[model samples]
Target chain A: MVAVATPPRGAKRKAKAPTAFGGYWRRNQLKLAPWLFLAPGAFFFALYVVAPILQSFQISLYEWDGLGTREYVGLRNYEELWWDDAFWTALRNNVVWLVLYLLAIPGGLFIALFLNQTVRGIRIYKSLFFFPFVISQVVVGLVFAWFYDPTFGLFNEILGVFGLGPVAVLGDPDYVTYGIIAAGLWPQTAYCMILYLTGLNAVDPEQIEAGRLDGAKGWRMLWYVVLPQLRPATFIAFVVTIIGALRSFDLVSVMTAGGPFGESRVLAYYMFEVALSEYGFRMGYGAAIAVVLFAIMMIYIAFFLTKMYRDEKGV
Target chain B: MPSITKTRLLAFAAATMLAGAAMPAIAQDEPLTGELRIFLDTSNPAPRAAMEGMIARFQEMHPDLDIETTIIDREAYKTQLRNFLSANAPDVATWHAGNRMAPYVEAGLLEDVSDLWDEEVSRDLASTKGSMTIDGKQWGVPYTYYQWGVYYREDLFEQYGIAEPATWDEFKAACQTLLDNDVKCVSIGTKFLWTAAGWFDYVNLRTNGYEFHMDLTAGRVPWTDERVRQTFANWRELIDMGAYIDNHTSYSWQEALPFMVQGDAAMYLMGNFVVAPLREAGLTDDQIGFFQFPSIDADLPMAEEAPTDTFHIPAQAQNKEAARAFLRYVVDAENQSIINAELGQLPVNSQATIEDDEFLNAGFEMLSSAQGLSQFFDRDAPAEMAKAGMEGFQEFMVRPDNLDAILERLERVRQRVY
Candidate 1:
């Protein structure tokens, strides 16, 4: 959007003795203004984000309690993580979150397609579907925790109708991660639905009409015609869902605090539990976990960036 | 120089008089001036009022001192402690005793208040002196503490024809009877992890005795040691019997209370703090009773869990003189009695009178006679070890079959932490 025009070299010399400083500023302001505008963001990005990442790398090499003098223990933390079962559990849960969380994409698309209609109460239905995303995640976690309560939860009550169980989903290690993931997927599905609903509004109607003329109906119509049109929306949904899955901390914190014996812990929550929680001040170990988590995130982020760059180049 | 000696002499006389009477004529000889900042974590309404009232009384004693008090949320205070201790330390700050203060002490954040723990103070507060001591120096002074035991519904025990069990077999029989009556034996919540640690502490203390438990926490003994395994075996009896409320991992300590309150569960092995909520939940003295966790080995001297809350001067404090004076005021037997009476806890000072309340008196009696007082599992163990140990306890409670795996995991963590 830069509209700044360069003055002709000859016209610059012919201009009536513009002050030396003013002339220099006029020449360089276009080149420098963008950098000037970017300074605050770059400064903060370095200070808050980049600096901490680098510091975490440094801190990961030491044995420090976040209080005492640092004792350099190079690579020991990571070596310990190799044998650490809790670390592996957290990493495994993150993978489970990544895989199960992707269900939100198709789940959202289905809801979006169902809701894309001319109906009297469609708006009300749409808002109702969007309600979960609007509330704080803490509230969502609390609601779902109560919903899964063994003795009084709705899940058990439904199970009781068939004489199944008053099983404690959060108390069972095998089910704890899945239970938290289900809680996470609720808001996430709502989020993706909103994205797809907006995408549906921008869909080209003529393409659908052409598909209909060719006898492309139902699943075939969605597959051959409408799906390509929603690629951008799907891309956005995938991006958010994957990142959301990776940084799944709040729900786990609120629901169980990595209970059922740390079964529900994601890397993010485990890192905090190790670093800042009352029972943990193992700064070096926590930093090692953070660095591993960062490395995992960087892989996805780098891939996304490269894909975005290629798309921008129309490749 | 002579005037300084006179001030010291006057302070010593005041301290001696405090040992005999209610309140010392404090700060009388040498008035403390400048600002004295006190940070407290007693954010709950009653303890907050008790502390503020105590500080107000201290302010009255030193009217010239500009006393500033900042009360932080109890949980938030824990993580924020390191930050403030290093960055913007107050003259004095409240903290817990035992290894909870170890990190701060090792980091040189806390002032060594060995001088404050004088001959008289040492003898008077001797019970908690070990908890406050680190590396042969006293880092702080404990103000209040409370006992941990099985708090049961008296009516339910009476209904089942059960007396307070004083032996392992009796405790098990009591649990079995309660279970046959369609009642859970104990209502524990391991959601926060420390509640399970409470059970571990008692079992270990009763199983192998206090010294072994302390050594195990200190990393001198391995987690997979036979003694440690025996402690787990004892705990497994309760778990295998399904004595605890169902789905306990889903509930907080407070959330587990309703089981006992509603008589769905017969007892709760918790700290004396549970008494307040029990009383508030409409349970009367007739309905509730306190008993020591029964002896697993009659040969072992009885040791009890009593987490002590303490105050320390930050090493970086600008007003160390005023802070030391404030600490003396805090541990004065009469002041401790007043504060703990309001707090519904036991005063650390030996001469301090227990509150007339049934629970407080029971806690006081139980603690006073106990051979050793543990600072709970979480406090006794190092921070990282405590987390791993407590998690293992929670796991063992849910899946008793996983005991071997859990002990191995804790052994690995214990190796790393130490």
Candidate 2:
């Protein structure tokens, strides 16, 4: 639609006097307010998170029992990791976890779309779908372990219904990693679904109606209009999914404990096994692994932050 | 000159007051008055109850002293103890006796109990005096020492017409018989991974002798040595014969215990602690039997794994004298007997009378007859070496084809450490 145009040059120009205090307040207050609000949180963040990161990095360079004189080994720990097969296995597992975990975003979005309707007792269905996320990871590990049990597990029972022999989901090296990942995805998918559900509620109805009038329906509608609107939610979902995958420690710790010959070990569990568990007190070596893991996580964090910066600048 | 004279007079008065206070401090060596905090393992109910009783007796004996004991699970105990000792250390905490104490000892975290051990308890437990001694000094006093070996089901053996194996050949034969009968001969859980290393150490000790076992763990002997290969060869034979439980890596020690308890498996090579759970699962004393791991070579010097649990006084202990007194009371025959009765462990003190408990008596008898006592694998070896070594053992057990690769990797780890 076109509107009538007005002449550009001779329209009345209005000039307002600048307030005397405007520059002073703008120069000083603008700078002061953001930092004042950030100070307490930033202090805590520096104390708890940032400081420990630096300390862990420092500790990784030395060989020390939790106590006793720390010997500076320079890069010996990192050097050893170059040939450490277990460390490589752990790193490979983490990559697999990262790649597989991204599936949760789409899976969660699908579930959220399915449950976004305002039917009777939809709230109950939503809560039921969200139930697994509320339970402790420890409990989730135990439940999945039982489910994967070859002898009397529900999974084996289901297999029996098809006249197939029971598969050792947790016991076999070929399947243990997949078994643990499945357990991780249970709650992760639920968490992502909740995020998408909220995002769907905030979707613009007018945009959807316009798309419908334009024959953008089903997959076409989802791809063109709906998903663009869900970008913020998807970004959050992807960020959290990546973090959850990288930090997949608890289920692995409780379920298989990086066993079936340590075939299931991710970096987090392997780091713990090295540092703390009966494995040994190789704190320096463990910290080296932790640093490597932190470096990998930093790449993804930087990418996400850059995207967010661009989006904010556009706003 | 007048200010100097006044300062001299004040110094004289202060010295007089200090001397007065020192006299009372020496005179009232009465029992320490304040709370004595103890951190102990709470996984098992019996020992916690027994400890509470002992604490009550200590409280009654010295009305001025109060004891606050916190019992945590074994895993949590390690984490909490490490944290506590690093920060607000307790007066006395339970710990393992060997290399586990070495780190704390080096850090000056443990109180030097050399004087106490020399004057009081050393005479009572002369046989175990060496166990508590580290370097040139005694760091702590062990209350109980437990032997590790195979515990088998008598009923399963009887059902399969298998006799208790007295030698390596007989052991293999018995394992074959069990396998033929569709029963697994060994039930092992490698989820913790250290349990598998226990078998490795025992096999190595039996195959090569105590000195070589020590040398290998100490990183002196190459892991690919012929003697080490022989141990793996024997282990490979057992695996080939389908002797161990299927999918051991998926199971914890507790989970594998059921196989033995349910008669699905014939034997469990574990520490004496497994007896409590075995008995709890409704297996009678008659249904189970304990044996030293059968000898691989009859001429080898036999070394049984006998890890000891001890309590040490922290250097930061507020009441050092009272802590010493409490340690003394714990090792005394009367208290040792009570502890052993409840704890199902052999007493560290030889003079402490053995009770009627069958398991403890068997453990005591076995320890007494053993040619030598070797600390458990994880305890005897440095922490780094033990982790690599145990993982190697697990890998070898699962896939015999990987033995050479595993041992080579372990050798590389050992070389790097040295």
Candidate 3:
């Protein structure tokens, strides 16, 4: 078979070594192309995300004051966190936030159902409803802060008309966290509504017709057919809402600054306060708090990844 | 071959850039020509204008020196200061006097400026130097400070037939009278958590004196101390009389200004800086009056809250010579006065003449008449203790029954922090 390696000798050809880099690359380009494209993103993710997460873990073991020398104190920072009242309060608030934040899903669905009908100027109404999401959480926080103001706020004015109360939502420790979480829910619900609306648009008409034929008209039709088809949207809504609740910082920070006695603090805000606030640079302690938050988040992230993995495998 | 040459050229460029780096000791003796970055809080319009004037003047005086500045809001500055001070620091930066500068000094983040305190600075403003001193070494230069006291509506007080009360009981009676007359006696905003501390500072200073106030803030005394509890007890009287505006915790000190002006609340305890804001809010000079916080104990000497704004050179700063020169030039009596005139605040320099305004005059008179000056509670206490103390103060204001729990928590923080 030595007729110029079974090729037409009319071509200008030279024998190339199989071990050459270019030869190997050319041979394996299809298999390596995806990985090559992914390299840049992986590098940046490692640098900004993975590296900092590890660095925080390492720093959590130290007693550093940012500007001064760092002393390795092992798990002392974490140990201190165990007895820290603020830590417990922040953890409790975060749990409350997570539990209450799920309300956005149902809230969004309720709103979507009401707003889904075709009516005159309904697009304008939908836009107005979606307005909170378009604006930033910072602005929303400020708005809600004014709304919840005890004396001069619109909320108090409303109460005054009813001869009810001038309740200080942020001032009372009992109501501060709830007040802030409600502010957060305003935008989050709008986000969930959008997701569900998109999901509702893609719902199969044939299934709806079939359900309608089987005496499923209202709630029965939605649960039997419509809801099953909207699983993807519900999943997305749940994941984002959970994450939004866990990292609920901007609204709490803008609204309360974890004040009226740190009653409204989440772990994120508490971490920032301990490390970088006017309170001395306890970088180590702050890092420890960050590590705890990361650990808590990791559980959910792992759950999410496994769910995605299994779902993909099923498909 | 070209790539090899490029690498060599790159190395050569870096070497030339560091040409002045070999003899670092002798570099300080060279003429000051590099950049002098100043990080300061100039979010307020008046102070920002004043700083721009100062920066322009400095640049005019020294054409050879280059200056850069990073401006930030005051509230954000508290956190941003620590972030930048440790790395890529500016040559000179703004900071508070007293215990606010303690942590930075302890960490060796701020440079020692004792050499700048010559005979002239020593003879006239030694007290300021003492406040910025840690372990007998000056760490910063105080350029401005202002008095804090009760700013009341003169017309409202007159209507209520209330005089400026000088004793504790008289103050309580006045508060009761104001309440009975349907006027809120005191308006405070604890949203930022520092306004309540101003009240705490005044009460503690009046009841226990400056020495005890300083000792308490410096963590020499426990929050469980009888005298400390006594300070809170005196504060409780105002609370008992329903003195403060209802729901004060939801407003900032600025947001609380309306209650004072609209006659809903009669008096406001604040620094002299707010006079400009107050005027902007439509309260004229004749309508407003300043009075010292009433004395709680006859034996205790009067001490006023006067939180000073100071400047310091960061220890890690690159341009030391220019920074030292800038601090020296900025704190000259004339410069301090010029900045203060624009800022509507009193200059730290005793020789600097403050502007002729009703509140300014009253503040100067009040400060001069005082036996001692405190840098306010938050400034005098370390950040951790200050935060806990202020939060406790806010709690006590909101729920006076939580006094025991708040004090116990503060004591734990004091023990741990110190």
lDDT of every model, 2 decimals: 0.89, 0.83, 0.86
Model 3 — interface RMS deviation?
1.4
Clashes of 2: 0
Measured against the true structure, the TM-scores of the candidates, in listed sequence, are 0.90, 0.90, 0.90
Error of 2 at A263 (Å): 2.5
Instruction: List clashing residue pairs in candidate 3.
Output: none
Candidate 2: CAPRI quality band: acceptable
User: Per-residue lDDT of B312-396 in model 2, one digit per residue for the tens?
Assistant: 9988765566677788888888888888777777787777877787777777777778777888888888767887888788888
Candidate 2 residues A75-169, lDDT tens each?
99999889989888889989989998888999999999999998999999999999999999999999999998877799999999999968878
Higher-scoring candidate on DockQ, 1 or 2: 1
What DockQ, on C-alphas, does every prediction get? 0.60, 0.39, 0.64
Q: For each model, chain A TM-score?
A: 0.92, 0.90, 0.95
Report lDDT (Cα) of residue A247, candidate 3.
94
| Candidate with the larger DockQ of 2 and 3 | 3
